[model samples]
Target: LACAFMVMSGYCELTSVSSFDAGSFSSKIVTLESIQIFTTHEWLPAKPTLYFLCQGGNRTGLPDVKKVDFLYTFNGDESWQPLTELPERKCKRCGLYEEDQIKSDDVFDEWELCPGDFVDGKYVHFKEKEFNATFACPLCKPLEEGSPSSASKNEATAHGMNVALVIVISALVSIVVISGAAVGYKYWQKKKREQEQARFLKLFEDGDDIEDELSLGNTL
Candidate 1:
């Protein structure tokens, strides 16, 4: 299996802005512009075949590097070669590695490749003991500003949603309060009616006892 370690240092700057697909803002092409190897990591004197590897097991082989400490530039022919497509919001694990015949491939360096890391559509990654490389993507750009009307529309929509949620919550609370008040009033009325009935029954019982006493006194 191929492997790589992370150690990066480079300078990147944006020089121009280019239009990209509206449907796929995150997707942008990555191309290799140049690379200079510091150490080939070989035991014998031999040319090293290098390749780029990224997430999802994507690989692209580069031209064989003939010498160390020498800068190799790619012409327009290789400029069109797509190394990978990177997303603006997410980073992909990518690296350079040497192809090996007897064992697993040796890693030069690996790092999280992110479109956001590019300044002015270009990024340079350098590992002190391994290699220094430059990658370019003409279409990669910073977040573009939308029209004022669009921003206003989005804000208005969000405000309207908040208002609707408040209205719904208020309506529910009012309904619960009204229902509770109605139940309390009904309970009060029932209690009052029961008290009135109890008072009337007591008066009737007292009248019957008084009549019985008067009848008994008259008999005596």
Candidate 2:
């Protein structure tokens, strides 16, 4: 029996900007350095989660991002948790201040994002590499040597096979072209020899009278 399948596509994009402003309690605008819009497609079967990819330093009144915070939701329902977590990770005197009282300045130059696998939420964002947690993400399995991510390794393998196939096909084409050129050169030489022989025979078929007349004139 013949089976058929249908495919559908969906897309979503998230951009990291230098700043975001929410005015009148609703509309928001993200400001960045001159990139109009960056887009990524989300497949129907695999809905890729949109991460903010926020690094640098926290402009929001959150804990020093280097110390604790990583993925932060600024305006929506996860707003309070994002703001509170920052202050909690501060020094005792620093923690006592209310979240609103905290200054929104860049601090701690060496904040580092924990190595994380993005697909399937296997590793929590900003979770330490040597963390004391179970490997829950489908994409975060320990590969032996070459494979990077579960999905990334498969992609790399497929691309490598494609490149190998192209090289093989190109080599075959080059061989065929060189062989064709050699055969063509032999055919051209044979045709030139045949034309010369035909011309020589025509001179004799026209008789030696024309040749004799030319010789007699030269002698006179």
Candidate 3:
């Protein structure tokens, strides 16, 4: 589709293309109308990535789009027309640039699983032995596959096991210490009782000799 847009705003005006020679191009004469810009933020590689939608039907005839080239012209200067070729990767999951800076203004943003695929499209890219592309909304990115949820669960389980083991070991150590203290205290108390009985027996024997001597003196 041929479209024209005002350089100031990002809106594109719809234009029709007719058959013509290779050098000569035909365009429908339509008045320019001002429209709102439709700018979207896509997660590309560290380098800039281009996006395109397929315009072919299913399984029968594949689209003849061999490669995509992005053409850019500056706001006022039409002299410099830059063309860039799209770079292909083994998998879209590789070389993804993570967005950590300021967030976008839109509350609901679509996330494509692959790098080059557009949002809300069904023809997701896949690899034979490598990871495949999966699309997710902005809200769903946090809970997507290989996220922190599984790791967090594993950490929690490990923490709980450690806590339980610590509690059990503490209880066993306290029981052993308290039992040893009780046995030592009982032994000390038994030795004290035996020493007191021995002292009483010694005093009784000494007093019996004095009583016998006083009886003999009274008889004399």
- Per-residue CA lDDT of model 2 for 1-220, tens digit only, reads 1222222111111111212222222221121111111221322333222222133333333222222123222232334222111111121111111121124421221222222322342333122331121113222223334434435657878899999999999999999999999999999999999999999898887778788888999999
Worst-scoring 10-residue span by lDDT in model 3: 27-36
* Model 1: per-residue Cα lDDT at residue 192: 100
lDDT of 1 at 26: 48
Query: How close is each model in CA RMSD to the real structure?
Result: 19.3, 22.9, 20.6
User: Candidate 3 has what TM-score?
Assistant: 0.33
Clash numbers, per candidate: 2, 3, 0
TM-score of 1: 0.51
Score residue 149 of candidate 1 by CA lDDT. 38
User: For model 2, what is the alpha-carbon lDDT of residue 63?
Assistant: 28
Alpha-carbon runs more than 4 Å astray in model 3:
1-147
Give the CA lDDT, 0 to 100, for residue 153 in model 2: 59
Error of 3 at 90 (Å): 30
Ordered by lDDT, highest first, the candidates read 1, 3, 2
Candidate 3 residue lDDT tens string, 1-220: 3333353233322221222332121211111111111222334433322222212311111112112232221221122111111122111112212122356322112223322232332223333322232322211112233445545556867999999999999999999999999999999999999999999999999899899999999999
Between prediction 2 and prediction 3, the one with superior TM-score is 3
Estimate the overall C-alpha local distance difference test score of candidate 2: 0.35
